[model samples]
Target: MTPASTDAKAIWRAFERTARADPGATALSTPGASVTREELATLASKIASAMRGAGVREHSVVTLMLPNSVEFVAAFLAVTQLPALAALVSTRYKASELRSIWAGIRPDAILVPPQHAAGVARLLDIERQHDMVVPGTDQVLRLLCVRSSGPASVLDVRERFGLRDPGSFPALFKFSSGATGTPKAVLWTAANVGAAAANVVETMGLDASDVVLAPVPLSHSYGFDLGILPLVFAGASLVIRDGFRPKTILTDLVDERISVFLGVPVMYRVLNRTRLDQVPDLSSVRYHVCSTAPLSVAQIEAFRRRFNAPIFQHYGSSETGGICLHVPSEIALRPGSVGRAMKNVGVSVVGTNGGALPAGCRGEVVISGEATAAGYVQGETVHDRNGFQDGFQDGCYRTGDVGFLDADGFLYLDGSRAGVVNVGGWKVSLAEVARVLESHPCVVESAVTAQTNPRRKQRVIAAVTLHDPAEEAELIAFCQARLADYKVPRRVHVLEQLPRAASGRVVLSADDLPS
Candidate 1:
């Protein structure tokens, strides 16, 4: 299909056709109940109607700070139906963080569950104060309090406004990695969303016959692209996991007959800790899709021993969706590999000076395709190339990750450019160091970071979680043997588990490290 025809309305029209053809098919299965495609459409229509009643129009931003419930999905689909833009944010965002996100967005309305309504109001107030604005000086932020029971939305479908004609305007805002309180909400157009969903369907082989398990938070881009958008576009059943409880998820996988399992590295590590005596019979799951963070060799081995399936590592970012993926026709994958580039996507490694690096040479990983977002959205400034390294040439978004492409075009990730630790004069990969530590027999997971030494030089530090108690000195020596002298961790902090963000990436903060 051509770019103009493959727009958001076209994707949404496909969904409407699916619902008409098979209204009885289950579209969403959550902790509460199952919603059929027919019922989902009805609810989305009601939400869309409500959005119009609330004065939401084309290009109006409606920020949703809700949980991974049916309501969240309804609001998002409604936005696309209205051809209006929306931003999904974490409900657990701190007040300051909320201020940062809301202040930048000129939202037409804000959606929140009743419990969080007060917080949202206060956050808006903070945003006004932070920006030195008076009442009615900015866009009127309408508050739509969503109910937790009965229906996904409060507005009645009978009070409906005609659906708007979908155009080239951005429809969704996908946030970058959760490290920053101030998020650079990456704008995604309907065309971008459709192209991304189609890419997943074509490359990952997702279809209506599959039931997907999503433990990743839907608010993040990884989950939106992998978990929500693809399922909605394909008219497939989605098992929405509210939280990552092993027992509940394990039971649901079998009960729901999940055919595709989407998870992250931390989730796999936690599942690896389950006793062999009580492992879930995940035979129904054909594809164990893992992304967001890199999987260590130990983790891969542990998953192999625990389950009969192979975890296909996915490589992408908020800037681009599903850059490289594992397909059935690809050559056998190597360790630490994230498969090859998807259809219509181009990935290359480039030096700091924007020159392309030869295959097998480490450098910044750049992506170009329909999957790449429109770039960061701030107040009055939608920097179309803010996330790119050099500039936006050929639709490429420079992924801050440091990686190398092999001879066969498979991508090998060492770590992120931002995650590198400088030790005196030498630079080392935090992921590389953690991979070596996690390889230890007693270790389950690990995270490495940069710390200031007494000499005021940057030193490498480590934090590890072990199945069995082990000496820190012994773990350090193990890394010393596998890594170069400068790359070895100068100090190790033995912890039960590393502090993690909602996305399951290890959180590197002063509190997470030793004094």
Candidate 2:
């Protein structure tokens, strides 16, 4: 399709048309089974029918707390088929976390996996006494349980909320991690999801023949946009994995003939340790994309050498979707760069004074484009009078990421905005230091955060998980060889495992770490 013909609205309309035209084509696959387009459409239709039957209406928030599987896909699409909004909650969340999220979102209904049905029921019962039905009646908060083998029982509920206009359907409700503060929900319209899918498909050069293996969960933005939606929109085959297992992924690559592999940095690191000889032929894979967090140059090179495929770096967030993607040419030129801004997207590095910085100057990275969110749900607006600013510009989301662009427009990430260690007058990016430390052969993973130091206002501290425990002095010497004197970690803490989010992002909150 031509560029103009491949816009978001157009692609989504195409998806609908294709579904009607060829319902029998394989659309999705798991480890042991697959779902054809016809089956997907039928299941989604049935679920939507159930929602309509349950009194769901336009703009109603429907919470989805299920694992990464066919049921999750059906539930998401089913919710979208109605005018009600869909909120994706991680299954990894504990009951306490779910209670907090429920209070915040005040969703009309929650679709829970059978495993968590009893806990969800108890939580809803507690909310019932408080009379906190923000969007609808108490009956609206019904649970749609999935049987192990038979059809889902929520068909009647969906039918009660059948939408007259699919265009008005609210796509998703994404919640930010409450680590920084109270968690906030981001509302995404069907139009927004369609646009994001189109951008990703075009940016990645995906086609019908491509088989995508998504290791990330559908609840996360990276997996939803970069993994699920793109393949569905392009009529490409989707191979869904419940979790990230290097051996399992390697097997899928060979068994499914997966052309596209999308994962986080940690996933790639795990895959690097896999015994390639034990897996089936993986030579069919084409592009392997990594996102969510920065991938080190060493890790990128190692992955490339092992897989013989280009490892592309992508940068974006939940609020903005995918704003930047590195193409093959750009990847070759700037090995660790997050490439230039995506097509139809504008990116800039702004200083503290709010002015754009020249190339090679470190500053806050900001982005503006069609794919950016309209606003946050019940929170601050994403854009301001200056065009785009919230975190960065008036309308532009302050990425909270610290980076600079080269003359060629490639972006180099230093660290996250919250990760900088302010030492007296200097700013040290933890990611930069951690990368250097992790390059050591014995180091498996590492995180750098600001630690209290009476001698100085704050000092850089490193928390490392090693394949084989190494002495602090050895680690310090390793960092000294690669990092600057001031940037080298002043204190080192060894841990067996690093705290991680469901999205696979390394959690580095100082309060969560052992003192």
Candidate 3:
């Protein structure tokens, strides 16, 4: 097997060439304005030089929370020039969520939206609750707003900041969504980012001619790596939206002449439910890549039939950028597979004993090679229930997902090990059902789990609290209409209340249930 290709010069070299080759070509754009490659590079250089003057060194960690703005792209590209790792924090995160993440990272510098400055300062005051060093000018951890307090001196573009060794430090630090529980910070080295971008560019045949859409939040790894970073190698045009709205995106699909769309399953579900009288001509779109969460077969089929567009499944996590992407030509062969491991990456299925499982045998999935991150910060386990660990074993990062590899090497996910309930060889995801149930007006909140009955196998069960009185039969019918027959919960129990964790995710346990 070929070793992980960690050559990290691709981003710097590609950015320079793309800028010089066509100085006037648009590199990134929003509804407000556009920036050419030359202009973007110049802005990035200025930001990098300014950051250097603030005493941030190659080893310092910089956290960025600017979203859906041209400044974010410029700042991220500027971070590329410095050896410091840029951590992208979600702007949508609750104040408490942000505090939890920030307390742990204690970034050497933070770039927050100007409006959030006061709130963030309050969050820092709460930092005294955690065991972390508060950041400021006393050295490494300086905080900077996206908008400078006062204006500005332009430093030489050819400054010392641009001379740092690109491969000497990790390039990214991102956090999990914390949908299941507390979020964990994950780090990706320069090699990881470069390899992931290369894999995507190769698999999709994306190029300078392609116009990609940032259909999701740029702060999320989904948008940063898939939507933004891929442009480093391909020099493609990026169309940024203010935020995700069903009507706005549909309009852009036709108006932007977009060739590629980076989206998630939730977005597609919304689109499918919102029918179109004429499925706007999406002939220009070559790849409608979906990731972030698993896309159900019903959702996928509905989207494809309605739009006449191929909805390819992309499976990966914040820890590992793009593990599998369904290629267009191979779609017919492997209908639901996440596709094979990308170039310079390795994937294998492992049994309960941590032994390699044969083709078609479901087990925990483990991935390795250049595209995968080194590990989570401080070796913390992101998902404790999964049999996998944080770091790579034998160079492979044990993903907490359970799935089997076919003879063709296509990986099929069996849902997350913690979230998937096995019912006599059939797999059901609790997260999937929760979404469907939450759609019902009566279902104020719900939790899904499994319990073994006389059948000797686990049966799907959903516990729900209602806004108004609703019969169990009606709710079951509601799910039956939305999900696959097998995926529908076997039992829907009406509970007075559901237990919730600090992160706001429903906790499913006997102790938390109503008596």
Candidate 4:
């Protein structure tokens, strides 16, 4: 596909082209059934017709609550046919979270599996609702359909979906993981959607023959860009599943002849620790991609030694599409580098003065590319008061990430700027402290934070989940040896697991830390 054809309309067009080329080819492979490209496209059109009947216009928002399945893909594609915004609500979220997001979005219609109909209505306090089932696929998907209540719009067209010029027509509405703070509603324009899909397909060298096994939620950016968008751009096959299951995933890798694996750090950590009686041959798997969170060197090494495949680290944000991916050839040499800027994407590290920092200097990571989103859903953009800045031809997004790029343009991340804590007068890096703690043989994962003492002083603290027996004092001592005394954790808490969001990102508040 050429740059000229990469537009929001290209997403649906590309899928249609692939279906026309080979309709019988399997596009989505689920545990229940396999959906051909033609079948899926037809399903999308059927759902689009239903949505149109429900007063879904060009700028309407259609919320999706289904899990990762053929139903979700078809519903999302259906939204694109109408050229409306698909506000993806993950089924993995709790009922309260669902209600909150639904209330904020106030979508014209929502699509869900049959079982959640009553619960969704009750939670969202909907007095009247109409449900229609789209038959096909299988028993589960046969009952999957859209529920339209014809809700009144709360916000105007521009404020609701962030629709502006023709190039900035909203396509997707997703919430950030809120790892650093409260989750914000993000809007991706049609151009952003087309460019995101194209960038990943081109950068990763994905093709129609590649079968991607994705256990991540399609509602999130990481899964959508790497899993579903590739299928739209390159005609690749998608093996979608709801949650992570290491053993079952291993079985599918061989049975399904998987080519690409998409996952987060937590899933990789569990898979690294999973004991297998006999390791299945994964020769068919070409790429093992990890995103959402950074992978420690220990994790990268462990997975490499166990599977003989290097874990390719993917770095990006919801506001910005794919910023960088690990260069396969340099993965071994630069163990922690997140690769140079992605194809057609420009990455720069800027200092506090907002000037681009020299190579090898750590600063805030700013991404400028065709794939970058317009801004948040409330009509913010690169030139607005938001973190985004306007300069590059396509505009730039301030990623709020702290990292440095080497002379060769390879990017290495330390952590987020918000991850820094002030203890006494010295500023301490929580990620550096956590890194030292996680490096200990017994620690599997760790989270570092700070708390204010009675004297109004910030106290650095840490928490760790260990694979073997270990004490808080030992972990604290371990960090003390590596980090400066001021940066060393004043206390360490031991836990079986840390609280994480649906995206597998460690979301910790000061209250979440043990006193």
The candidate, 3 or 4, that scores higher on TM-score is 4
User: Residue by residue across 205-317, what tens digits does model 3's lDDT show?
Assistant: 77788899986778776777677865667788888885678878989988888998887665776677665667775656888888865566666666777888878888777
lDDT of 4 by residue, 421-456 (tens): 788899888888877787788877888888888899
Quote each prediction's TM-score. Answer: 0.86, 0.84, 0.76, 0.89
RMSD after CA superposition, every candidate: 7.5, 7.1, 8.4, 3.6
Off by over 4 Å in 3: 1-10, 125-168, 379-391, 421-472, 478-515
> Model 2, 466-486: lDDT tens per residue?
766699999998888887778
Give the top-scoring candidate (lDDT).
4
Off by over 4 Å in 1: 1-11, 125-167, 178-182, 278-283, 328-333, 386-391, 453-455, 502-504
**292 in model 2: Cα distance from truth in Å?**
0.9
Q: What is residue 382's positional error in candidate 3, in angstroms?
A: 13
Highest-TM-score candidate: 4
- Alpha-carbon deviation at 358 in model 1, angstroms: 2.7
